[model samples]
Target: MREVFQAELKSIGDELIQMSKLVAEAMERAYASFETADTDIAQEVIAADQRIDYLQNSLDERAIDVLALQGPVASDLRMIVGSLRMSASLERMGDLARHIAQLTRLRYPNQVAPARLVDTFKEMARLDIKIAHKVTQLLETRDLTIASEIIALNTSVDKLHASVFRAVAEAEWAESAPVTADATLTSRYFERYADHGVSVARKVNYLVTGEWDPELSAALDQD
Candidate 1:
């Protein structure tokens, strides 16, 4: 029974890795859509989202069965919990990527963002790729230190997002908003995507340390 449960846990890990690859590719496709204005690729991204959702649900069911049948404890407990967290984050990342692709499809060849703002948004997308890559690495290595590093980068992404908002507001106030809206919206989508990456990294940290970082909660503080 223990052996079977262990095998089930390993299967869950495999599925999560597969799911991450799909979601990561979906993100890459989202950015590619922006550059190429390729509605076909964008629609592909939109369509792939269902696969992510289904995988998460399927993984959850197997994970739950393992827990119920074998009653995992100690490290097994941690791995199962972590796998669940990772799947949820990956699922949300897929949703974010799908949204960006949908938004691109809705308004293509129409100057989505101001030239300068679009450039900044492009940078944001590159960062999204970085963050997604890091999330995959952390999962494979289970390196809490690397997870911490990724979490720190999230602050940098947040700063960039804030800067984007300020830039968009200035453009609007200057009566040059028409070209900047797409850029602003794109940056927002990338920011949220980075957020999901940070979330997955923290869950990896949980697998290693059994505790969530305090600084992330601090980031939520407004006072």
Candidate 2:
């Protein structure tokens, strides 16, 4: 019976890693579509978000089933509970990517960010993709080291987010109102994407250590 329960728990962990990978792919494709205003790729991302949603729902049901049948305790209990939380974070991250893709689709034929700020958006994409990749690694390894890197990468993303707003606030920012709206929203989506990555990393840390870090708790409190 103990072996059966352990196997079930392992299955849940595998599913979580799979979900994380799907979310990361969503971010990458969304960034690519955003850069080129490619509706085809943007549409692909929007559709993929639904798959992430399905995974979240399915995982929650499985976790609940485990609780009801297996009666997991101690670290096993922590793993199930943390999997649920991490799934939520991954789903939200997927939504953020979809939102970014929506901006691209909405402004089809016209670039979203101003030409001058394209490089800035590219940097934002780079940081976001890096964090997303780290999230998958953390899920697989449950290494607190990856969690620390995720937090540090999130800090960089936050700085870039502020820069986006700074450009919008500048006197020389002469883009039209529509372009300004795209810039504002695109920046926000990327920022939130990174935030969700940090949240998932924290959950992984808690799953392994069985103790929540105060810094992660504080960071989540603001969300």
Candidate 3:
């Protein structure tokens, strides 16, 4: 029974890493499409979202199977349950990327944002990718030291989110200016994407160390 449980856990872990990679890539491509104003890239991002959704469902099934058959208890149980939660987070990340892609598709042949803002969006995408990479590392190391750093990184993400939203809230672009709308939506997308990455990290911390930090919620006044 224990061996089966371990195998199941390993399988779930592998899936999480793969899902993380896919979601990160989606964010990259979606934002790249926005940067280049390329409809083809946007369409690709939209289509890839379906695959990410399928992966999330499969992960959920494997997690449920583990819980039912293994009856995972204590830390093992936490790990199994957290897998489902993290899967949801990863799926949401993909959804945000898809939203960006859809925005690109809806507003083609028009500048969606200032050239300067394109750099900003790319920066946000980089942040998303970085956080995903960090979470993957945390999963393997289960190092409390690394987990503590994530809380600080989440702070940086929160600041970026606030800055982006505030900038958009104050801006005024004409209705025909798809660039402004796209910029606003892209900023929001990155914010939500970063939030999901933080969620994944928090779940990992809770599972490995039995401590759930509320850094993200606290940073956003969510609770």
State which candidate has the highest TM-score: 2
**Candidate 3 on 1-223: residue-level lDDT in tens?**
7788788899989988888888878888887887777899999999999998999899899898888887878887878788889889999989998888888778787546675566666677778777777767777677766655655666666677666656666646234445556666777777778778777777776776576566534543251
- For all the candidates, what are their Cα RMSDs to the real structure? 2.4, 1.4, 2.6
User: In model 1, what are the clashing residue pairs, if there are any?
Assistant: 114-179
- The 10-residue segment of model 1 with minimum total lDDT is 214-223
lDDT of 1 by residue, 153-183 (tens): 7777787888877875663445245545656
The TM-score measured for candidate 3 stands at: 0.87
**TM-scores, each model vs. reference:** 0.89, 0.96, 0.87
Better of 1 and 3 by lDDT: 1
Q: Residue 104 of candidate 3: its Cα lDDT?
A: 76
Best by lDDT: 2
Instruction: State model 1's lDDT.
Output: 0.78
lDDT of 2 at 135: 91
Q: Lowest lDDT 10-mer window, candidate 3?
A: 214-223
Q: Native-vs-model 3 lDDT?
A: 0.76
